[model samples]
Target: MLEQRGILVPEAVRGRITRRMDPHVMRDWFRRAFAAAAAGQVFGDE
Candidate 1:
């Protein structure tokens, strides 16, 4: 799908993204993102 849209991911870029996208890291990122979103909602979106 990405290739069909002309979005070419270079090998280096792919490698870096994959390297950091471990289950633990991804979970941590999602947790932080969700926390931020919840905070924003509570704060009324400054």
Candidate 2:
């Protein structure tokens, strides 16, 4: 879903997930972080 949504996942979360997950397992935590940042920016702009 992340790739489909054009999201950029972070390397930190990616590394931690890789330690406990299969190399192909993908979580969208970084996308959530990015969304948080974008939301903050939008509020700041207002």
Indicate which candidate wins on lDDT: 1
What tens digits encode model 2's per-residue C-alpha lDDT throughout 1-46?
3434555446654455456544322233434544553323212221
How do all models score by TM-score?
Answer: 0.34, 0.34
- Clashing pairs for predicted structure model 1, backbone only: none
Candidate-wise lDDT, in order: 0.44, 0.41
Q: Give per-residue CA lDDT, model 1, range 1-46, as digits (tens).
A: 2333344545664555467747765565445444443322222221
Clashes of each: 0, 0
